[model samples]
Target: MTDVVSEPTTVTGVDTPPASPARGRWDADEHGWFGDFGGRWIPEALVAALEELTVAWKDAMADESFLAELDAVGREYAGLPSPLYEAKALSEKAGVRVLLKREDLLHTGAHKIRNVLGQALLTKRMGKKRVIAETGAGQHGVASATAAAFFGLDCTVYMGAVDTRRQALNVARMRLLGAEVIPVESGSATLKDAINEAMRDWVASVDETAYLFGTAAGPHPFPSLVQSFTRGIGDEARAQCLERYGRLPDAVAACVGGGSNAIGLFTAFLDDPDVAVWGFEAGGDGVDTDRHAATIVGGGAGVLHGSRTMILADSDGQTVESHSVSAGLDYPGVGPQHAHLAATGRASYEAVTDTEAMDALALLARTEGIIPAIESAHAIAGALRIGPRLAAEHGPDALLLVNLSGRGDKDMVTATRWFGLDPETATTDPVGDPDSDPRA
Candidate 1:
């Protein structure tokens, strides 16, 4: 791995600017390379736009007024500093203390709002009147639309046709927010396809529109920018943990799709060697099978969606379609920074199967009365799976922090199909007797 610079220079069209103050240990270097993983890989037409964005990002980060505006908007509108709740019942069940970083309570019911608001503000700063985005499970799309409406920017979201059907509620929500929703039917008709379409639109409309890339996986400035906006998750959780429990968590866990939430939660803890960072990928069925989105666990290093990262690809290095019960976790590639972290042994990643994740969703709902998004369920499942080992190693005092990245309201359709909650389609009573005791 390349040694990271304390203060790295920023990249312009061809020249390099002087070193700017570092945002964090994991911030990418000049040219946007995160170690060997991230760098701009795109058509020549998009280079100017990326260069513009890179400069804007560096300037915004250095601007006190911009920082204050973002913070004020976050606290006043998006619900900043979300609560850290100790899941007593879950802790008892897992044999280790479990603390949940409740990002699900944020506006639009997901952590995607943080990045959206930041990029939306950036769009305004750049004097852009329109914003475009791509989404998988639709949380990011909804968040983007919400931000655009709030900021009075024209919003357009490209979503997978499959996702539009599965996550219909969120698609509707986005439309109701006055954003135009376009369903991409090409490729796997999923996140990857949506991104391709969005990128195509961005290349054509670079001057008047800003592409609000959903996750931290995209090229260059996006990975760093998304991390900067969402790292508040870790910053808040770290302080909350210190204040509430007097120490950092023994382990920090989050589900990794394109890796924004995991990176967000892992950022503040990366320098703390004693704290283990764990990322759970979506294992649709299982990793042993071909149907899974477990990029780090099952994939090799390759470029996908403009960044060199671990990807689900076939023998000829072609991208494979990834499957997952949760739409948000259905992706073939991960963020370049996650690739760097795993490569350097600063973090560990594992695949959580669909069955395991659903079981965890049910467990959390019954135990804590909190129905987490399926993406977040993967983290909960991973925490449960590793809890015993943590307990054995650290005794009963082992504490695990799991990022609840989103609420499950948008996932009811998928969860209903998975859990057989609908009587019309019921083959078996998945929830047990309706007449029985509610807690039983």
Candidate 2:
């Protein structure tokens, strides 16, 4: 069961995970099983390739030169050690000393690049000349294309037809990065569809291509590998918290879709007995309405996208379509590590409605002058819901670190539609005067 900070109960009650060295351990078994959540469930055609990747990954883990190269690339190119900014205005509103790990400032935007650069480096080690990936919101695709361009490797990104139309700016960004963008028309024409198409490509091109998984929900090595690279988000925040606040935070929150960002932050605080980790999921209409992506709350255990974890699936084990205003958080399943963390009570998972996320997006924009990507807004929503509660429970000094995962420039159109602001006049309008706006 998880510890409860008595207040408004923004997060549900669960038994706290026990304090043990192994309770929140990271590495999976050789087969990549994370307590039955991760393992290669791919067809026979890709097994050998995966095994080779597993071995090379192990070697890369021990190679000091490889690590130094990765660190150099992260700092000099992709922008590691992203600032931990005090959200003073939002903090005052929330009644907690809130800090944001600003991943939004990193090159190519968002936390996706942390894993992309690492995987691209590994691609060279594997002697692969081509890299392929799937994207929903297109941030990952842009990051992947940037990495491939840097490495001079051929890159292809599969995106849903619907997503390309919605997130077209990112589509153009990916194209400009010289990556081929393939629009998938199957199924719901979203992330899962893109994944299906990418998997087919991998099956046929395994020898020359590495399937660079976009998030942390895939088979074993990917879940672990992506987290290993992006854990820098948490690592930097952990140190920065100590330097700035002189103590660990009461809680850390991040939005969970396929859960790369959340896992990146959570893995850093797993062993800290006092630091609680929380994950907020997308609640489209609301989790109770069955139109949401609150997988941990409304879903059952099932296999999806090559991993066995919490999933939004029907009785026959077919994955359900998830909806959210935030395309990035609209997945049917979460990473295996998140499932284990939730099951063991190492963390609590909550849902924020689309309205709540949009409200938080606007709140941060007005109060802090930062427009969070809609996916990151879920974390902002959690802060708003949990901050006052923490103050009530832990007093005024309650500190919280939120992963500010991406900037919201990509969501201006969505924000414009959600808040009903005229794009032509909204930029010059005063910040807090939503009443002066046409929507009011």
lDDT of each: 0.89, 0.86
lDDT of 1 by residue, 349-417 (tens): 999999999888888888899999999999999999999989999997988999999999888887888
How far residue 167's Cα lies from its native spot in candidate 2, in Å, is 1.7
Pick the TM-score winner: 1
Which stretches in model 2 have alpha-carbon errors above 4 Å? 1-24, 423-440
What would the TM-score be for candidate 2 when compared with the true structure? 0.92
Candidate 1 Cα deviation (angstroms), residue 266: 0.3
What are the per-residue Cα lDDT tens digits for candidate 2 across 266-379? 887777757778999999999889799999977989888778889999899888999899999999988988888888788889999998898888888777779899999999
**TM-scores of all predicted structures:** 0.93, 0.92
**Span of ten consecutive residues with least summed lDDT in model 1:** 10-19
